[model samples]
Target: MVSNLAGGRRPRSGVEPGTQLGALEAYAAQAHGYLTAGDDELSQLAGLLRPLILESWLRGVRAGIDPMDPGSERGLRGADLARYRDAHAIAPLLPLIDKLLVQDTARTGLIVVVADQFGRVLWIHGNPEQVAVATEMGVREGDDLSERRVGANAVGLVVRTGRAVWVHGPEHFLHRMHQLTGAAAPLHDPDGRLVGVLMLAGGGRVAKPEILALVKATATAAEMDLLLTAMRAVQPAPRDPAPVADGPLGLDVLGLGQPQLSKGGERIPLSQRHAEILLLLAEHGEGLGADHLALLLDDTDLDNGTIRAAMSRLRTVVGAALIGSRPYRLRAHIATDVEALRAALDSGDVESALQLYAGPVLPRSTAPGIVDLRDELRVRLRTAVLRSGDAAVLRRWTAGADGRDDAGAWVAYRATVDRDSTLYAQIEAKIRVLDRRLGADATRMQRSRS
Candidate 1:
């Protein structure tokens, strides 16, 4: 396939006005194999082959035919006519040659062309003297003289070699085409694979140095155009995430949490009761109705009054600023709309969810049940980000979590991003600064690696 960057940088395809072929001229003939069935089919087929007939006449001088004389003809039947027709069909691609043949009667020349990708004649152009030389070798405008079509000629050779080449007359490996000269360059995809060839042919003025440059330039342009066309047909890859704070979510919980969060950062302090409520909700990310929540508490002691009060207080603290309403429910952000949270997690959109679940589920609240939920949700979110293969998002999430100062998470984040093990010791050292147990484990991990 072609790369998207090949447009506008290619050259133009036009032959020089006084251009002449030199020693590099190569006459490569492709086999013409046409099958004949019925008279009607043959006539229809010949009609389709008419353009090639005209192109043949244009390049026929080299084959000992008169271009101006309508009556002068070569009695080609099935096979020869097919080859002739195919070559002429490709001749139009040689815009210069095609225009000369159509508009200029005095211009005598021979042009070399190849199939774009399918092995058809690409073009043919020339003055009279040049045309005569081309004809002798069956170098017509629409010839399918591809390497696979014939054996070795300037056309096939350039395609076969996958590079630029020049062949003059007998230089052709095939004796059938020993009367022409050709200079050609290979066409390629963005990946640099050869796609086709551009060739110039004429027997009159042999081996002109400028012709080589012209042919190379033309081929380069054609290749670029082909590549551009190919690139337009392909789709691009997905874009990577932007920087953390500048992101839509404002924070990514892919790896570790931000170790710092102040009043300016909208940081919230967790109260014992708020923390307890959050832990419970984080534990059950699944729904828990008010009745179910009351059961978890000592409702009998206060006739459900105590339970309702706890729920009210939890709402006022957790969703207070976010929802701005009483009865907003505890663990409301994470416990409610559980489906959206799960989807976001499954789709690797945890970074977005982290910001949604920001400010703790129930700040400063703590209960046995709440602690379980909080720890569970934290672990689940952590695991999901790691699986997503985006450690940075995980780091951001961890930075905002209770483990913002946790060394294990930081080391893991760094290790995932850098793919290095040497940082394990540093991670353990940092963890030791926060928690002795983690520091010991970190040391063990580093020793294991060593």
Candidate 2:
């Protein structure tokens, strides 16, 4: 059957309730009443009116009608077009709009309309013939047909007020939308934030449950994906720094708070050289053998005998932390599964990655080789974070900054600042000082080489 929409009056601009918002409010109240009464059938019935509402909202704009005011049934007149407020003229939903393109068997020749939480249509699927009729009705993508001023229809009514609604045929205030039946439901986040709307419209009689189920299922899946992505954006890495002690250097290997350098919580102080060595090796995941560590210190004057003496003193200072088998190694048995850690990061499972990197790399002693390896890995990790350029990485690098000896933190800050000015301005005053220090260090190193 040919749609009755063609004979309906085109909207006039200055008409009161020119926009579809008023109609949307009315329908929303009705839907809410149905829900409050525990009338599931009526609630489902209300849910079927979304598509026409969306269509009307869009058409109201093109006709220069006040999008929030009900337009006149009278023919379009220049004097009538003056009431356009353009205030509540937010655009229609777009994300779920494309789904309206496909025809579903459950709702014979139905036109589907889905929108994102922001009221943008995303998918519009429907039968080709029904779509053609809808096109004649001015129901289409890139159109915001809200029922607020455009009068009663499904999408506008449900989404504007975050309620489910159904508007069938002549019940739509605008005579233009009388031939179509529409059902709409609001899409919401876990926190009950409205994210979008799912709608169906057709020329045939509405199949309440079948259409409702389809719209609900689509909304649920989209919400799940949205939540997962949002959660991953802010999760922090899981690593706790070692606590301070007066006696031996304390390093926490198990990631628990137990102190390896003290007995009964009493402090013991190690010599400055021993403390430096312990800190360096503990930061390096790979064991730094004695000889390579000696090179890192540039201590060519020290013989193997002297290095052995230092190792012995370091062991005595932190005996409890000694786990590795070799004299050159910090702890006798620090181990990790690099493959597993990397896999977790690659799979976008950052929580697992943080869990896997939980403990200190080494806990007993520090060697030059270990220090160099740690530095290299730190650089690698920073570069990886820079490449991602995500919001979290930028925040982390910002917090890592201190007055001095924060080269890694400074580098990351600089890398992200140009792209994100708010972060850049916060660290701007400190950037110059860091650059000068770094430059001087570079010059000194070059002079030493020559």
- Per-residue lDDT tens digits for candidate 2, residues 316-344, read 77663562423344543222233345466
RMSD of each: 30.1, 27.6
For candidate 1, the 10 contiguous residues with the lowest summed lDDT are 26-35
Off by over 4 Å in 2: 1-107, 116-122, 234-450
The lDDT of each candidate is 0.43, 0.46
Q: Highest TM-score: which candidate?
A: 2
Over the stretch 1-450, how does candidate 1's per-residue lDDT look in tens digits? Answer: 211122322111122322322211211111121111222222221211122221232123223422122221222334433443344323333454334232342243545555443233444444656656555566654444544334445666554445565655543434556566667777666666454566676663535666667677766665566566668867753333322331111112222233121222455554454444443444333334443343233212123356567766755643343221122232223323233454677677777766555544333333323322344456566666555546667567556755475444565565565445655565545656644532343233332321
Positional deviation of 312 in candidate 1, in angstroms? 71
Q: Residue 80's C-alpha lDDT in candidate 1?
A: 36
What TM-score would you give candidate 2 relative to the actual structure? 0.31
